[model samples]
Target: MTRSGTDRRLSDDEMASWLPLIRLVQLLPQALDRTLREEGGINHAHYAILVTLAQDAEAPPTLGEIARIAGLSRSRLSHALDALARRGWVERTSCSTDKRTGSAVLTEAGRDMVRRAAPAHVAQIRALVLERLSDDERETLTHLLGKLLPGIESAV
Candidate 1:
């Protein structure tokens, strides 16, 4: 069922409500990617993969799991893993439980890289985003985002 032309257009309040989120979705990833590529010699996607492995209970995670968590396709994740492996940031080992599955392990070097990258990343985040918000605004933003996250995850 299609709406009439007037109804199809976004309402002013709807535009106002969603514009910031749309801008954020467009800009944040590009900014973060640029920063990580410049300072860490890795893109944001690669950083996410490493961080996911680092956060794993085993300090490593199966390739499929990492791909899912990172929201990347298997081929893209495989290519990123290959690059990380060449940099000595990650090591791939055949899973003991499932020979066909491979796991990516974060190396000491990778942990050190993440540590080095953290300060600059946090500074950039603070300067560009967090510093602009008041305490109450920050809390509200967090709460609102938290509320929205489950719905987004369910869609995915």
Candidate 2:
């Protein structure tokens, strides 16, 4: 009853469902990135890093924790931090108690930038995604994606 790899292929029904999801996955990031760049001179990844830091602004978390929360690899996080640091929007610092551990601190400028950029980002998201779906459809989509998240997370 097992199908060989060579024999495996998506059925028309499966392709019908998958094609839009594939397109959405690829196009959504580009769309969001365009908005982010225009509104704040930052891309989605940089915005994610800033927002992650801002979440714990009062007591910045370690780089490792930030990496996990921001869904970025450590090296990518380091590179993003370098850009943010150079822009004076973030500062990388050692933990006072743990010399070997480091944290990304969101600067006042970063906070201000998020404040200014968030509204536009939200509006764009609404325009591109949320408003397009009915409430029930949105809820169903959220539920379906949540089911897929575990497998996707594990792959990463």
Local distance difference test values of all predictions, in order? 0.86, 0.89
**Root-mean-square deviation per candidate:** 3.5, 2.6
Per-model TM against the reference: 0.80, 0.86
List the lowest-lDDT window of 10 residues for candidate 1: 1-10
Winning model by TM-score: 2
Error of 2 at 126 (Å): 0.9
In angstroms, how far off is 109's CA in candidate 2? 0.7
Candidate 2 minimal-lDDT segment of 10 residues: 1-10
Model 2 lDDT per residue over 70-140, tens place: 67899999999999999998998999889999987889999998998899899999999999999999999
Off by over 4 Å in 2: 1-7, 56-59, 96-98
Clashes of each: 0, 0
Q: How does model 2 fare in lDDT?
A: 0.89
